[model samples]
Each structure stands twice: as structure tokens, then as C-alpha cells.
Target chain A: MTERASFREYHQNIIERVATRLEESLPAQWQIPSSLREAMLYSLMAGGKRMRPLLVMAACEALDGNADAALDAACAVEMVHTYSLIHDDLPAMDNDDYRRGKLTNHKVFGEAAAILAGDALLTHAFYLVARLSQVHGVPAEQVVNITMDLAELAGPKGMVGGQAADMEGEQGLTELSQLEYIHLHKTSDLITFSLLAGGRIAGADEQKLEALRTFGQKLGLAFQIQDDILDIVGDEAKLGKKTQSDMKQEKVTYPYFIGLEASRGEVERLTAEAKSAVIEAGLADPSRLLEIADYLMNRDH
Target chain B: MTERASFREYHQNIIERVATRLEESLPAQWQIPSSLREAMLYSLMAGGKRMRPLLVMAACEALDGNADAALDAACAVEMVHTYSLIHDDLPAMDNDDYRRGKLTNHKVFGEAAAILAGDALLTHAFYLVARLSQVHGVPAEQVVNITMDLAELAGPKGMVGGQAADMEGEQGLTELSQLEYIHLHKTSDLITFSLLAGGRIAGADEQKLEALRTFGQKLGLAFQIQDDILDIVGDEAKLGKKTQSDMKQEKVTYPYFIGLEASRGEVERLTAEAKSAVIEAGLADPSRLLEIADYLMNRDH
Candidate 1:
């Protein structure tokens, strides 16, 4: 099998393990504010590929930290990602009616409830992070650093900036650089934070962490490009999200700017740079991260 | 002048100090996501009464912490409050068009920027907390504790819950207890956090902090009641916000259930309880706090 196929299987297995653990960590459904808890779980457990958290785990493991030690950090990052998706799909934003082939949170739970659910999830994300420092027996400094990075990435300088830029694009932007601006904020920043945070949790030093950041940076761009490619080529049923919505909305995308083929080439190039950086970090074991970098570009859904 | 009017002047002074400090801390305009920054500043600096932060400062002073050291905490709480107001006024939410006698954030900055500004302000609130720990020479553990408290107040079980309940009330809540439920989540929780976090910064002992929590609980309820009364009797120009909109919306308020006179009495009773707590804390100077609490019921706004 190609490196991409085998890596997909490996990531799939790890993500399932993490997801199961997350479910166990939550306050029992009954203890939660029934309707609000349901909305959080519905979006949280609906199960994306768990890419961000998986990055956190893989980076920690690569950096010689116990993957389990970073579990809550991993979960928190995923939770933040989930909350953004929930809010982003609200009628006032993307007005998305569906996500992951299921009705959007706002669609099922009403706009106010969905918005509150998103706020709750985001808040819970930090709660988990704070709790993790206590439970994982890590340095408070590490927890603080990890939390700060997560907050910044999930906040204005990162994903929120991207979302704003993306929203602006719906009004039709004339510049291709603006498309890149959107991608950097919307996708690349958090992906970069995910890997670096995992390393920090493991006590990875500055030099090593720097290399891993370069790796994550390239990987995120590749991943977003791959997303554009998938929307063009992958099966809608399998992907479980709407296809051609970008085109339909006249939203800017790599595919729209560079054409599908050029975007395809960019992903391939980014994948190579990403893999090389991981190899340079000397942080990975048994070629798994290198393999995963290859696989990120190959994800079809 | 009555003791209450005397106290109002004290609250007004504290309000001015906070406003001056916050505006001075900010560049006339910060360029990082300039539009969102503008939105946050517009809402936060738009002539707010500074009641929450004053409570925080007062509680800190009562416990032997310098009110100056509490600046970041004070500002952080206000930012969170402002973020909520911005979101609460969104087209997808309450959709009101005015705040503090000016256009709401969404009305001024466009909906997407408004949403983003709210998210940024919320995130920045935490950012400020983390930085405050350093700037104020607060112990790391104390800083972490305050951060956690701030997060909780803003999160699912606290302010967000209040917002959710408020939303549900629009669909019509039949039970008076449900309206209290709304107040607890929406108003009381943040108020509680405001006072509690202030004490935490000051290193208040458990007994004193707990007492202030009691004070805050009463004050929060009274504060909301006063707000309800203001909606009925407040002059629009004096309130610096739209005054007549709430009753027109047919939404519930404390006066809507208990009648205006009862709500006024409740505010007076609660304000007295709050003052007693400050005195009980046994601070070197309880004058400022006493002044603020004594005047709680008399604001035309």
C-alpha cells in the first residue's frame, strides 16, 4: 500500500481511541444541562477525523512525551475546533444547514441554543485544559503556554481572522492574495498550533519545536488545499459535508483561484515540505509522522 | 445629599478612573484586526457605568489587595460583558439596534465583524488575565485560579446559560421560577464572578471571599431588578441607551413579574446587604465600597 493509505489507517485507529476516551471524560449526559449538553455532544461526538487533536497527540508522542499525558490538551483543541464549526454554520454566518452530513447544530437546536452550545463548548475547552495540568502532573507553565497558544490560534489572530476574511469573500473579493489571507487565518494557524502545543506538552525545547512548527505550517496549507481538491473530486456521501457550496456561494478557494490542477500541485508540494520538516525535527518515531504528513494530502473525505 | 447620592458620586469616580485607564492603555486605534478592535472599544468605552469592575475593585480593597493591581481583572470582566452585549444584539439573536446611545457593534461594523469582534474581545479578556498575572505580580497559582473563574463565569454553566434561558423566554416561560432561572444564568453569574475574581486577585481568605459571593448574589438579583425598573422609568438620554424597547418587545423582566415598586424595594434591600458584606470584610478603608453600594438603587440609567 502507498504511504498515504497505510497512514490513514493508522490515524483512524488513534483518533477512535482518543474519541472513546473523550466520551468517558465528559460529565455524564444526565449531569449536563440537558438540552445544552445534548447540543455539545451532538456536535462533539458526531466525529470528524479528529485531525487537530490527533496532531496534538502525534506531536507529543514524537517529542518523547506520553501521548496520554497530552490527551486533555488534544481534546480541548478538538473541542475548540468543534465550537468554531458550530458557530460558523449558524444562519447569520455561513447559514450552513448541514455539517458532516448531519443537520447543523443551529438547524436542530435553534440559533440561540446553537450559539450558546458553541460558547459552552469553547469555554469547556479551557476548563479541560486547566484540569489537564492538574491531572497530567505537568508543569503549570506548560499548561499556561498551551492554553495561551490555543486561545490565540482559536481567537482573532488565527481562526477567527480567517472566518472574518472568509465572510468578506462571500461579498466577492477581487484579489487572489485575499484568498490566501483567508486560508492562513481560517485553516493554517490552528493546525500549526495543534502540533506545536502537543510538543510543548511534552516539554519539547525551542529548537525542536521550531522545526515541528515549520512542519505544521506546511502541513496545514497542504491540508486546506487538499480540502479544496476533495470538494472537487471526492464523493459528497463519503465526505458527509456539502459539495460545491464554495463555488455556489462564489466563495474564494484555492481551486477557484489557481484551478483544481494547480491547487493539486500545491498540495503535493506542501506535503513534501511538511514531511521533510518532520524528518528534520528528529522528534518522530518509526516514520509515523512522516507517513501522516503524506496522508494529510491524500485524505479524500 | 443623602448617603445614596453620596455613594453615586463615588461610583461615578470609579467609573471615570476605569474609563480613563482603559482608553489610555489602548492606542487611539490598534491595527491588528482594526475593525474588530474598533467594535470592542466602541462597546466597552461607550460610557458604561463601570459597576462590575467597581465591585471587583471594592472587593479587592476590602481584602487588602490594591485596587490598582486589580486593573487587568477589572478590564477583563468588562470585555467579557461587552462581548456578550455585542452577541446579544446580533441579527440572529435579540437584533437590537442601539447601545449606550450609539449604534450597536453589529449596526456599526457589519454583522460578521461584530461577531468576530465579540469573539476577539472574549479571547482578549483571557489574554488580559494571563498578562495581568505578570503585570500585577500576582502569584502564578492565584492567576490560574482567577483565570479559571473568569472562564467558568463566561462559559456554559454561567453567563451563557443565562443567555440561553433569556432566549427561551422569548418563546414564553410560564413559570416565575423560570424567569429567576434566566436571571441566575444571564445576570447573577457574571456579577458573582466579577466580585469573586476581584477577591481572588487580592488573595482574600476563603471566609471573606465566600461572604462577598453572598453579597454578589444579592446584588446580582437586585441589579437585574434595577435594570428592569430602569427599562420602565429610565429616561432614554439618561440611560445612554434605548429605554423603551424592552416593554415593547413584550419580554419578561423583574418588574414585569413583581411590579415596579416591589423591584425598587428589592434593589434597596439588596444594596444594603451588599454594603454590610463590605463592612464585614473589615478593610482599612470601606468608604469607597460603602459609597458605591449605597447608591446602587438610585441611577436614573
Candidate 2:
């Protein structure tokens, strides 16, 4: 198969596996309250691009590691991602009524259930990571390291810190540096974490891991800039939400800071930089990673 | 010194150490946004009884383990506890304006900041546990175990599950069994986790760990019962919040179903049972655990 066709097949396969695992992630034995479980599953199963989990698996496979070993971590990252979305959509936060084209968690389940669901998803993410050692026989030391890294990336100085800065910026932040800082933590940190975590699970050396970090940083910026571009000129039906939300919220964006054409150029530049990083990493296979980068650059939604 | 006086001294000493550690927990190097940092520290350092951290240390000491070894885990449990309180007091949840006689997190920092602060705190708890292996040289296997246990107890099936049930119960839950389920998961689970985690840190064997679990469950129930009694009869000045607020909210407390005298009796019964379990555990010293049981049984706030 051609590289694009192979990448598509692999992506489809992983998405199916991830969806199944996520459905079964919260075991019945856990006896999570029925309503709470529903709320968590509602948003979790609503389905996004599953980009983070895919990154984890692709990174692991590129290292010649068994992709199955990274499955739990893949699900874990997605859970964290979903929880953030749910909380961000809360009335007190984004106050959005829709996400991924459906009613937001709070809109469907009420604010209280939505909050608990988000909290549960975040807490459960760690539980899944801890299970890596017990279930997959990944080394305890590696599991601990991943746990620590996940917390740092997702915690205050990482994603949470980025989010906090983003909210503060809503009060009229103008500096390009400030905007970059917000995106770096809020958006890019978690993306970097997915790559690094997958590499760690595969026992990649520091050099390879650093390469993955660089790749993730570049790709994340490109991905986010594309999002901004889409918000301004993309089809609303394809994007699955209202367009011009950034303008409505009076939120700053790359397209706003630099014009749309300049923003698009930045995406290409970053994606090219990201592809080079993976190529330098000298993985057993880098075709998939390279293709994913290219695909992200061209996607409309 | 008499047992009471020495117990008092030990309690005071641990509280001081815990307070200092919590103050320094979020290192300056993390570069957390100033406002988010302030919001997290506001709730974390506001100080309650520090009961959870004390339980961790006391359990470790009782096992003849170095209490110092359990210090990080101690701080971790408190962080989780504090985060829960912050989220629970949000406008969509209990709508409380005050916690521990201070303005609630959302009240002081706005709903968005409060939500993000709580998320950061919860994520950071796992970070602390993972640090146990790196910082204190706790065995990686042991750290992994503690991480799993903490997540389970604090996640959907444990504390979060309890909180969800409690919120659901607010719509006229009358069953005594439902109340017990809420208390068991919400309050008792974390208490049990604190003891078990401390035991694991001290390298307690399974039998001893089981005893700690039993001790914790009983103590946790007794503690919640006392909280119920105090809500109706507590001195607001000492309690640091309004008395009878539970009644005003129409919350289903132990006394609400069993009457004040019966609830008091249950606390005594549970405390006695808890003390017996610790005695049976054959620890290096059970004096502190026994004293704590008594303290909980008699505390007015």
C-alpha cells in the first residue's frame, strides 16, 4: 500500500481499538455511580479526532515497540483531554452548549454532574497509567516516570497553567509572547507529553525522546494555528461547531495576531520542522509520523 | 508526659511539619501563573484539621516505619482533600461562599479560576506520589502500588464516586443505605487510602494492611458521624463556619435519620471498633492511633 493508504488504515485500526478500550476502561466492577458514569461516557465517547492517542501509538510503533503496551497510556491521555474539554465547556468557563456537534456535558447532564464527571475522568487517567506496570508488565520505574511526567504536563505548570493564562488573557492580552505562552502550555504541553510518554513506554533513549519532544512542539503549534485558520474561514458543518467563536468571545488567535495567510505559512513551516525532527530521530519506521504531520497540515477540521 | 499530652505534642509537631511542606510543595520553578498559584495556595494553606496527613504519618509511625518516608504521600492526600473541597464549594455544587471561615475559592478567584485551581491540585497529587521513588528512594514497585491505591480511592469508585452519590442524594434521598454508601465512598475511602498508603510506605504486609483498612473504615465513619452531630450543635467560632448549615441545605446526615443521641452512640461504637482493629494489627506502637480514635470521638468540631 502507498504511505497515505497505510497511514489511513493504521489510523482507522487504532481509533477502533481506542474507542473499545475507552468503553471498557471504566469497568463495571468500579461501580461508578450510574449517572456519573453516563455523564463521563457521554462526553468521552462523543469522539474527537483522537489525535493524542494516535500520537502515542504511532510514536511507540515507530520505536519498534509493541503498540499494545502503549494502549493504556493512549487511553489515559484521551481521558485527560476529554475531561479538560468537559470542564472548559462549563457555564462558568467557556459556557458553550455544544462540543463535537452535540450538547456539552453540562448542557446535557447539568453542571453538577458534568463537574463530577470531569473530575472522575481526570482522576481515572492516573489510575490507568498506574495499571501499566500491573497489566502490561511495563517496568514499575517506567510507570512511575510516566506518571510523574503526565502530572507535570497536565498539571499547573503545564496544561492547567496554560489554561489559566488563557483565561487571564481574555482580559485583553496583546503580546505575541503572551499568546505563545498560553498555547505552549494549554495546547502543546499535552501533545508533547503524548509523544514523550509513548517513547518512554517503548524504552526510547534520551536522544530519541528529545527528538519526539521537538517534533511534538512543532506539530502542536501547526495544529493549533490550523484550528485558528479554520475558525475564520472553514465550513461550519465540517468543523462541527459554530465558526468565529474566537471573535465572539473576543479571544485572541494566531490569525488575529498575524493575518490568515501568514498563519497558514506558519503552519507549513512548523509541520516541515516537525517532519525533520522525526526523520532525525532515526526510528525503525518514521513514515507514519511524517504522513500524520503532513495530513495535519492539510486538514480543514 | 501522659499519653494525652504526648499525643497532643506529636499531633502538633506533625501539623507544623505538614503545613511547612504544603507551603513549599509547589516549587517556584514550576512557574505556575500567579493568580492560579494564589488560588491553589489559598485553599491548600487555609488549613483544616490536617487530619488526613496526620493519619498517614501516624500509620507509618505505628508500623515502625520512618514517618519521614511517608511525608510526601501525606502531603499528597491533603492536596486531594483540599481540591475536593474547592470543587464541592463551587456555585454549581454546594454554592458555598465560605470554607473554613475564608471565602471559597470560586468566591475569591472566580468560578473559572477555582475550577482550574482544583484541577491543578488533583493532578499534582499524583505528581507527589510519583516523586516518592525519586526523592525518598522508595522502591519503584511500592510507589506504583501507592499510586494505584490513591487513584482508586480518590477516583470514580472512591471519593469522586461518593461525591457524585452525595449530589444525587440531594434530591430527597431517604434510604439509610444510600447515606452509608455516600459516606463510605466519599469520606471513608480517602481515610482508608491514607492509612493503607502509609502502611505501604512503611512496608506493612498484607495482613497489617488489611487491619489498617478496617481501622480506617471505622474511624472514617465515626468521623463523618461527628461532623453530622457538629453541624447541628457545633460552635461556629470553633468550627470556622456556620452551624446547622447542613440542616439548612436539607442534607441527609447521620443524625437526620438516626437522631442526635443515636448518631453519638454510633460514633462511640465505630471509634471503639476502630481502636480494636489497630490493637489487633500488632504494630510497633498503636498508642497514637488509639489516641486519635479517642480524639475524633470527642472532638466538638
Candidate 3:
């Protein structure tokens, strides 16, 4: 099979496995109050690309860590990612009703359930990480490091910082630096974590991690720009979310502030940079990452 | 010193010690983004009653773990508690201006920073626990168990669940069950965690942990009722937060659903229950806990 098709299958398979593992790992404590449980499950179980976990698994595999051991880290990242999405959609935040082709968590579960679900997912992410960190095979300290990396990335000054800036910027933002700040933390930090974590779990050294970080940073920026382009040129029906949210919110996007053609060129440049970073990581198999990068460059959703 | 006076001293001293030590253990990455660092520092430095951290110390002491070693756990719990407060005060949430007689984090730092600060605190909580579990002197697995306890308590199924219920209930709550859920998760979970984590760190046997849990549960319930009473009966200026938040939101509280006399009576009952549970745990210095229970029964804020 071609690299692109193989990458897609690898990505899909890992995500599915992580999702399955996550459901199985949830204990009775998670089952408390059915409505709350439903909310947590709804958002997490709602299908998406599961890109974060894929990065984790792929990175781990590349570095030589057992994929099974990395499963918790993989799932944890997704859980954190899902939790952020649920909260970001809250009335106080982005306030959306649809994501990934389904009614948002709040729409189906009510605001309370949605909030509880988000909280659950966030907490569960840690629980899974802690459990995996001490699994019989992996050294406990290393697992701790991986989980800590995730906690930091998903937290303030990283993904959350980006979010707050993104929201606040909508009111009155003109500077490029502020906009860059938003995307770097908000958009790219988690993706960077995804790649680093995958490599770290698999035992990638600092040199490899640095290369992957470069790759991720470029991919994330390009991915976001493409997001901007999609909002303008892509179909909302397929996107499953409001196509015009950025415009409606008056938020800064590459296309809105920097011009569409320039944004497209940036994406192209970023993709190329990302490809180089992957190749430089010196993995025997850069085929998967190369394909994934190209697909991100070309994807509609 | 009187029993109440002594525990107050105990709570104050250890919380400060834990807080100081925790500052040193903070993730190095926090220093990267100046804006993010400033926001986190602003709220964290504001400080509070330090009730959660105290519980961790107390629990650890009770279970035979050195309170000093468990200091990080105490700090972690407090961070989680503080973060919840930050988010709880957003414009779409309670929209409060002060906490502990100071400007609330969001009010002082703006909504964006407030959100990031809260997220940072939550994320930092786990990072601290993960680090704590790996401390040089402690048994790694024991530390692991305590960290796990901390994780579940801070997470969705626990404290976050309660917050979600509170937010949803604010719009127009109809049932007492909903109020109970909110109190249990939002008001009590962390407190219970605090007490339980302290004990867990000390390697408290299941029986001892159960006793501490029972004490924390009653204490937590009483604490929420006390908050209800304070909202209705305490001076606004003294409370630091808007006294009328629950009332303005039209949500049920101990005062709203039950009369003042009943709420007062419940507080006394729960405090006594908490005292008895701690007594059952058989502290070598049971005096400290006895002091806290008395204070919980009668505190004004």
C-alpha cells in the first residue's frame, strides 16, 4: 500500500485500540451518576481523527517502547484533548453545538452533563496516566515524566493559554505577536506534546525528540492555517461544525489577517519543513509521518 | 492552647510549610511564558484557608507517613482547589470579584489569565503528585497510591462533577438531589481527598483510610452547610467573595432548601461525625483534629 493509505490505517487502528482500552480502564468510580457518566462517554466516544494518540503510539513505536505500555499515555492525551473541546464549547467559552458531525456534548447532555463530562475526561486522563506510568514493565519514573509532560502541555501557558488568548483576542486584537502567541501555545503545544510523548515513551533520545518537535511545530501551524482556509473555502456540511465560527467570533486566522494565498503558501512551506524534520529524526520508518503530514496538508476535515 | 486554637495553628503552620516547599517543586516549564507565569503566580500567591493541604498533612500524619514528605501532595490539592475557584468566578460562571478578601484571579488578571491560571493549577497539581511519588525517601508504590487518590479526587467524577452540577443548577435547579450532587462533588470531594491523601501517603491501612474518608465526608458536608449559612448570615465584606452569589443565581443551598436552624443543626451533627471518625482513626495527637472539628462547627467564613 502507498504511504498515505498505510498512515491512515495505522492512525485509525491505534486510535480505535486506545479508545477501547480507555473504556475498559474506566472503573466503577467513573460510573457514578448515569447522566454524568453518559456525558463523559459521549464526548470521549464521539469519533474524531484521534491524531494525538496516534502521535503517542507512533512516537513510542519509533523509539522502541511497547505500544501496549504507551496506550495509557496515548489515551490520556486524547482524554485531555476531548475535555478541552467540551469546555471550550461551553456558553462561557466558544459556545458551540456541533463537533465532528454530531451534537456537541452540551447539546445532548445539557450544560451540566457537558461540564461534568469535560471534568471527568480531564481527571480520567491523569488517572490513566498514573496507572500506566507504574505498569509492571515501564519504569515508574519514566511514566511519571510522560504524564507530567502531558499535564503541562494541556495546562495553562500551553494549550489553555492559547485558548484564553484566542477568546480574549476576539474583542480587540491587532498585533501579529499576540496572534502568534495564541497559535503557538493554543494550537501547537499539544501537538508538540503528542509527538514528543510518542517518542519519549518509545525511548527516543533528546536529539530525536528535538527533531520530532520541529516536525510537530510545523505540522501544527500548517494544520491551523488549513483550518482557516477550510473555514472560508471548505464545506460546513462535511466539517460538522459551524464553518463561520472564526468569522462570527471575529477571531484572528491566517486567512483573515494574512490573506488566503499567503496562508496557503505558509501551509505549503510548513508542510515541507515538517517533512524535513521527520526525515531528520532518523527513524527507519519515516513513511508514516511523511504520509500523515501530506494528508494534513491535503485533508478537507 | 485550646483544642481549636492548636489545630488552627497546626493547619496554618503546615499549610505554609507545604506551600513553600511546593513552590520549589513546581514544574520548570512554568518559567517559559512570562505571561502564563505571571498569571499563575498572581492567583497562587493570593493563598487561602489552606484547608485541603492541611488535610493531606493530617491524613499522612495519621497514617504514619511523614507530613513533611507528603507536603507536596498537600500543595497539589490546594492548587487544584484554587484553580476551581478561579474558573468558578468567570463572567459566565459566578462572576465574582474577590476571594479571601482579595481580587479574584479573573477580576485581577482578566478572563484569559484567570482561565489559564486555573488550568495551570489543575495541571500542576498532577505534576506535583507525580513528582511527589518519586521523591527520594518515600516508597514509590506508596507514593503512587496517594497520587492516584489525589488524581481521582481532583478529577471529573469528583470535584469537577460537583462544579458542573453547580453551574447547571444555577440556571434553575428543581431538585434537592441535584444540590446534593453539587455539594458532594464540588464542596466535599476535594476535602475528602485532602484528608484521604494525607493518610494514604502515610500508608494508612484500608481501615484507617476509611475512617479518614468518613471524617472528611462529614466535615465536607458540614463545610458546605457552613458556606450556605455564611451566605445568608455572614457579612459580605468579611467573606471576600460576593455573599449573594447563590441567591443571585437562584440556586438551592442549605439555607434555601432547609431553614437556617436546620442547616445550623446539620453543621453541628456533621462536625461531630467528623470528630468521631477521626477519633476512631486514633491519632496520637487527636487534639489537632478535635480542634479543627470544633472550628468547622462554628467558623464565620
Candidate 4:
């Protein structure tokens, strides 16, 4: 009956809804070749926090937009995020054996399948948006803008560019600005896009959109810094994969540039900034956005 | 001038124009990491026939649409084609060492950069389409539809799905229908999309659109079968990569399922069908499309 508990319930409900919708929306396995379908589904359905989709839905709700309208966009963002994870875990990239407490996609379905699956998902993201326009009767014009935004934020100037920076930076000493660039594009760009996409779908005004963008940027940075802290000091079982792997690979991280204590402080600062942006922007029932940021900052994994 | 000679000149002009535009449009190397940009440009700008972009431009022109309106789309299709080649040549895929008379992208840029470069190109394809909508003042709605069509044809339902089937089929004796499926999707989907995308941009009517689709499918199949024939009988210097490698890998091909002469016959049959479809559909100047089919059928490489 408490207000905070009700918001918590609302967040959890959206997470479950997103998970189910993602499963439902994917191309039917029998229609495509079984192996390819399985590969895409395996990585996609593998249990994760569903944080990106949750962000999408929350932003949609905050703008008093139809949650149903936001569903496909939420799933689309998740697909993009999941595809990135699959590619980033490939032997040629991070070469990780596990992800989200399960065998990495390439480990489960050969590297070729994994790569193709990632391609399929990335491609499907656009297709789904098109389907959204058709099925939901959203203006084709709005969908075009949404599609462009997603592509721009996830392309060279955004996530892919960041990924390239991260891969190249693996060999060099980590600089703060360089690390920021990597994190901003590789991690935060997609996350920021997810929130903005949700807001856009909901018809948020420019001022509200600006607030969502600011919240997304700060929260994404905070979330990534928390990931860095987890890599250094968190329990292995809770984290799913091995700890100290960033150190093992000599990958750049917040902990590498700043001490553990300072990194933790930065997360707190970013989380606070994210919350204030939501409040300043006067989002309806700001509780959910604020709660999500707090949860991201404090998550153990 | 003879019809063949004039057609050859037309094709040559488009190729040169496409190459210049592709080079001019790509993200400058300095803006992104040099290695990643270099790897992408290596495969992308490397000499090929510029077939996909040429198809797009020709389709647009046939519809009496402004050629300038189709340039970004033409470049976008080529980028997609180039990215597929880059990933397909990786150690995990076809494992080819040379492409278009040059060392493969991975050979020059290392596996990580090649993979990342492929990713960037794929992501950038959409970005370019979005930019097309913005820069050319194309209707956002049309662009969304175009984006969807491209994504659908190139996603699991089309190219990526075909690739998965191809990869999975590497272990088994390839069936005839299975081979057709692979060809239709893996090789033809993008080609089909390219032609259709150009037509769509040109405001082609439904009848013309259907004609373009049929023409694309037949021509794509014919083109791929020619590749199979060339792999068996092509001179290595002309083909740019080692010939007869399909047999070495035990990969299935048109030549593998049908006799060499029969495969050649099929190419002729498909080319005739492609040309007739264009003519029957009442396109303006179907000569260019008809001629392109003949060129594909006869090309040594």
C-alpha cells in the first residue's frame, strides 16, 4: 500500500512485460532455419536485467504515453543491446566464455551462427520499428524520425564508434577522456537512445525530451561505472562472469583511471544528477525514474 | 555505337559515379579510429563492379526519378554488400585470404578491426538512409518504409537467414531446394532490395515495383549461379581470388547440383526471364536493365 513499494511493483511489472513481449515479437523459429532462429533466440531470451527495455517503458510511462505503443520500441532497444553483447563477446572481440550466467552466444551456437544472429537481431530492430508503424498506425513520419534517431545513436558516431575505440584502447594506457569516449559511445549511447526513443514514441515535448536525454546520459555513466566497480570488487557468482577480467584483459575502466572509492563516489554523483534532471523536468510521478537510477547505482551486478 | 558497347559505357559511368560517391560519403578516417575506418574502407572502396549501387541508380533512373535522390541509397546498399563480404571472409566463415585482387580486410587490419569495421558499416547503412531522408528532403514516411523493406529483406527472413543456412549446410550434402533458398536469400535479397529501394525512392507504381522485384530475383539468381560457374571455370587472375575453391571446400553450388552446362543454361534462362519481366512490366528504357542482365550473365568475374 506504500507509495515506494507500489512504484517498485510497477517497475518489476514492466520488466516482466518487456521480457514476454520480446519473446513474442521475434520471428517464429519454425519460419526461419531452425539453427539461425535458435541462435538469435538463445542470446536474446537469455536472462538479463532487461534494464534497457525497462528504461524505455519507464520513460514512456513518465510521459503519460501508451505503454502498449512503447512496447515494440522497448524490445527493439533490447535487441540492439543484446546484439552488441553477442558481438562484443565474440572470439575476435572480448572472447568471453560466459554472459549473464549462461554460455556466451558463440559458445552455444558456433561463432558463425552467433555473428549471423547478431546481424539478424540488428536488422530485426529496424524491421520491428516498421512493423510498429504499420500495426500500431503510428505515423510513418514519426517512425521515420524514431528509426533515424536509433540508427544515428547506434552507428559510428555512437555505439559502434565507441566499440571501435574500446577495442583499439585495449592496447594503450587508459586516459580519463579516452575512457569517457569509449564509455559514452560504447555503453551510454545506446542507453541514452533507449530512453529518448521511449520518450519520442510517447510524444514527449522538447523540454521533456531534453530532460530524458540528460537523465539517460548521467544514469548510463553511473551504470557503467558501477559495472567497473563490480569487475574489480564484486562477488563472481553475483556478477555472472569472472571478476578481475577487465584487469586480465587490461581493458580501460573507471577503477583503472580513478581509485575504487572515487569511482563509487562518481556513481553516486551521477545517480543524483540523473534524479534531479527528472525532477527538474517535472516528469509525472518522477518516482519511477528516480527509483530506476537509484537501483542502477546500487545494483550488485 | 553498338548496343552492347553503349550499354557497357552506361554501366561504366554508373560504376565510376558510385565509387566516387561512396568514397566521398564515408566517415573520414581521422574522425573515427584510423584502423577501423581503414579496414571498412579497404573492403568497401576496393574495386568491384559496384553492381548493387548501380542497380539502385538504374532502377531510380528508369522510374524517371532524380538520380541525385538515389545516391545515398545506392551507397548504402554497397556498404551493406561490402560488410557482408568482410564478415563472410573472416576466419570463422569462408576464410578466404584475398578478395577483389587485394588481401582480405582481416588480413590487412587484423580480425578485430575487420569485424568491428563490418559492424560499423552495417550500422552506418541505416544512418545513411536516415541522412538521406534529412538531406534530400525525402518524405520520412517513405524512408521508413524503405528502411523496413531493406531490413526485412536483409534480416533473418532474407540474407542473414540464408547465410545461416549456408553455414549450417557446410556439413551436409546440399539439397536442391536448400541451395535455391540459400541463393535467393544470401545473394539475391540485397540485390532485390537494392533495385526495389531505388524504385521506391523514385515513386514507382505498384506494377513497376512488382516488376523490379521479379527482375531482381531472377537476375540475382542468375548472377549467383554465374559466380558458381566462374568459381569452377574462372581464371584466377580475372576472378581476383582463387578459383575452384568451392570444390576444395566441398561447398554446394549450382554447378555442384546440376551439370556445368546445365548451370550455364539456368543462367541463360534466368537472364531471359529477368529481361522479359522488365519489358512486360512496361518500364521506361528497360534496355539498361536488360543489358545489365546480359552483362552479369557474360561477365568473367
Clash count per candidate: 2, 0, 10, 0
Candidate 3 lDDT over residue span B73-129, tens digit each? 777887888788887777756667777887887677776566656767788787777
Q: Tens digits of per-residue lDDT for model 2 on A1-301?
A: 3545577788898888999999999997877889999999998899888999999998998898767878889999999999999999998889999888899999999999999999999999999999999999889999999999899999999999999999999999888889888888888999999998899899999999999999988898889889989999999999999899999989899988989999999999999999999998889888878988988999888
DockQ of 1: 0.43
Better of 1 and 4 by DockQ: 4
The i-RMS of every model, in angstroms, reads 2.3, 0.6, 3.1, 1.7
TM-score of 2: 0.98
> CA lDDT, every prediction?
0.77, 0.91, 0.75, 0.85
- TM-score for chain A, candidates 1 onward in order: 0.93, 0.97, 0.93, 0.95
Candidate 3 vs. truth: CA RMSD?
Answer: 4.4
TM-score of chain B of each: 0.90, 0.97, 0.91, 0.95
DockQ of 4: 0.66
Docking quality level of the chain pair in candidate 1: acceptable
The residue-by-residue lDDT of candidate 4 on B43-144, one tens digit each, is 877978989988998898787876886988998988889889998999999888888878999898888888888888887888778776778877777788
lDDT of residue A103 for candidate 4:
91
Quote the true-contact fraction of every model.
0.36, 0.88, 0.54, 0.74
**Better model by DockQ: candidate 3 vs candidate 4:** 4
TM-score, each model? 0.91, 0.98, 0.83, 0.96
Residue B65 shift from truth in candidate 1, angstroms: 2.7
Q: Runs in model 2 with CA error above 4 Å?
A: A1-5, B1-5
